[model samples]
Target: MQPIPAKLAALAQQENLHFLLAVESGSRAWGFASPDSDYDVRALYIRPSAHYLAIDEGKDTFEFIEDEWFDVGAWDIRKALRLLRKSNAVLLEWLRSPVVYAADSAFVRDLNTLAPQYAQAAPLLHHYRGIARNALGAMDLHGEIRLKKWFYVLRPLLAARWAVQRGGIPPMTLAELMADLPPAAVAEIRDLVALKSGQAENYRHRLSASLIALTKTLAAEVAALTAPAPPAPATAPLDALFRTTLQRVYPC
Candidate 1:
């Protein structure tokens, strides 16, 4: 393991937590990372079985933030599975992120297999739209805008569009979403992406008509579409997996 991920794993081990899955989650994982972007490490962990027997359930999250190189946190597996059932877009992104640091292939495989079955368009659409809208709020129509906000907004909008069109989980990286954009917009995006790679996070670029227009158009389309009411998933399978994993990790 690389130094950063090794540190994350060792930290978990010290805490007596079993790391079920760990991967990059933010701009670094999204493929448009600036030279100084934070390495946002996210993971799902399983606690020792004895910890679950206590009357008070302990906190289910761990967070550590230092420099841009190592901003790390994790969700307990139980919390992660609950969020997954709700089709939480952030958790879904964690599962789909291309930069995995540590994972049990079987555990990752089971969750990936179940993701499509439980994922619904409504929650994901609402989640991504909120992200895009927030990003747009940070942008200026006629003045200098943070170059990073474009990716922050456009990436989620593109994911929402893909979910609306295809009714599935969108890919985690911005580059994957770029394939669906118009050629002119794509060109502009490419230039911005290149700039982001070389420049610092505070770097600002002049707002352009084409990028703004594209963002508005996609936002409108996403707002118009209705999320399909997906059927409730059978929880028995998830329950079994949860119990099985807990036992596997902390067996007698």
Candidate 2:
């Protein structure tokens, strides 16, 4: 964690950007990181006010990937807000991530407040289902499967279930999403997590019949769900927040 905070700070300085929020957006944040898992740091930043005013808007993203261990990325605040308006799953997860590397408290607070208002169940359900389908597709149901990849399929299947049943944004952590599962399913998932924690990312093992069964059940249930599309939220509030953030970060 020491290296990460310093790295993020250096990134902020190097890019001359004001970081509004930064957090672990991958396995570490989701509470299921293997011993060798790398940091997936994601952030939202504000460029100099003049950059926004220029006729040619500069790049809105920053990415730094060092080897296979440290991966850091940031989205300019304006770009983040536009995605937020459409309830982007990645942005939604970032706002709820358990591990924070950096933050402007007020900005993060305001953004979280506005998140639920814009989040629509249908899109999020679709997003999670797609993730599960893709991950599941990569595995061999009758043969050996990448053990770690099981989580990739399970997490989103459970998230889709959570979103459909709860009618809201799903919790970011897998443990939270498992709270309401039947005992057998929970036990199987726990065993898988324990095995995954000590193993390398490419570890392979026979797929658990029960776990795969549960995955198929949950996937079918999510696919069958029909949530009404939520009404579009007005952008006035987001616009105000954007303006206010600029003023707060760069008072003139």
Candidate 3:
């Protein structure tokens, strides 16, 4: 198999994209990958200037699956910036992911500087709360759940808690989120992670009473949160960045 970076480079060439950034955007990046976890690679790319000016612009996103082990997706730069303006948590997490496979340093740095300005309390809290609630809803009546679902629920709940307490974009990894958790809870989560690392994706485990209780408690705390949706940030900066990036990447 080709190395991931080489594969990504080839993909960019095929699509005629300037791949600006690529990173592990799923379990591996979140620090909870099982032995068989697929590399969920995501990227941001820029098209030639003419693509944006065309009356009928094509798809702004790309996706490909390479066997069962590599799942790749990318968003065009304009689409990414548009989503970023709305405080898209997924995009924010991608930028913060520690397992970057490739990057244009200037682009990443500029985007990172601009991202925090657009990240507001209400949307981020809402995003994480929804994910946690949905994951919790997947549990059976007896609290039998996939081993992976535990991390699914816990990570988002912790991230929601972090947004409320920390007032900025939360760290992408579970280990970082665990810092605010109680020692007992943290220890339990560590054991769970260890178990998950050896298990397959569909492995099932009965949710422990303590974990169930913690889940409920965190859910309530998150549910109780109320923040006014702040007004959107000015788009002038994003507009300028987009123009500058286009000029830089596709200059005549």
Candidate 4:
């Protein structure tokens, strides 16, 4: 709905970025944005075939700012693949973001079709480890109720569950996480989400029973997240596929 998104989309098109998808992926998307949160726009696109063949080191990601409150970033197709191999959840979510500024190609459609074949277990491990490390620290050090600290902990824990349940890597969001929790844990997460959603920073959010119950459930899930991932499915020639999609999207 913001004009900023439209401007950024135009910039991406001018650079021959061939937008495949774009979406809000920051504090706003997470539902806890401050009044002036930056429009964190992300997109994927293809460059000309010549750009691919005459490769400098393939830069996987790029950023730009059309103006204040309106910045943008893009990922190259090959760069996206490299991240996909390692299970980058942010990248996966970008592929699935709810907002759409500009998307005028079949490139991501083609890539999504190939995703099932190539997405593996290695990346999910890396993704969860980083999530736990980053948020667990905040939960430990921040005041018991700091910035809805529980979401940081819960997000990664549930995502780990999702990976195990689905038998392959899938992207996660807070909205979807609640339905899958044990009743008690769900209550705890709700308390946290309610506290965080309103942008409340109570020095101490005390939900005595709920907090304890949720942490226990999360601890168990964390263990599974650290456990070895199951094997990935067979690979097809994604390079050929990428090229074919590129030719079709980025003509001549």
Mark the regions of model 2 whose C-alpha exceeds 4 Å error after superposition.
none
Give one digit per residue, the lDDT tens place, for model 2 in 100-155: 98899999989988988887787888899899989888877668887768788888
Please provide, for model 1 over 114-210, each residue's C-alpha lDDT reduced to its tens digit, 9 standing for 90 to 100: 9888788888999998988887887775678787877788898899988888878899998888787778878878888887899999888886887
Q: Rate the local accuracy (lDDT) of all candidates.
A: 0.84, 0.85, 0.89, 0.63
Better candidate by TM-score, 2 or 3: 3
Please give the lDDT score for candidate 1.
0.84
lDDT tens per residue, model 3, 1-252: 789999998988998998889999889999888998999999999999888887897789999898899988999998999999998999999988999989988889899999988988788999999999898887762656788877898899888888878878999999999897899988988988999999999988887788788888998999898777878578998998889888998997
Clashing pairs in 4: 86-123
Reference-based TM-score of each model: 0.95, 0.96, 0.96, 0.79
Of models 2 and 4, which has the larger TM-score? Answer: 2
Please state the error at residue 89 of candidate 4 in Å: 2.7
Winner on TM-score between 1 and 2 is: 2
* lDDT of candidate model 2 versus the reference: 0.85
For TM-score, candidate 1 versus 3, the one ahead is: 3
| Steric clashes per prediction | 0, 0, 0, 1
Q: Give the TM-score comparing model 2 with the true structure, all chains together.
A: 0.96
Query: What is the Cα-based TM-score of model 1?
Result: 0.95
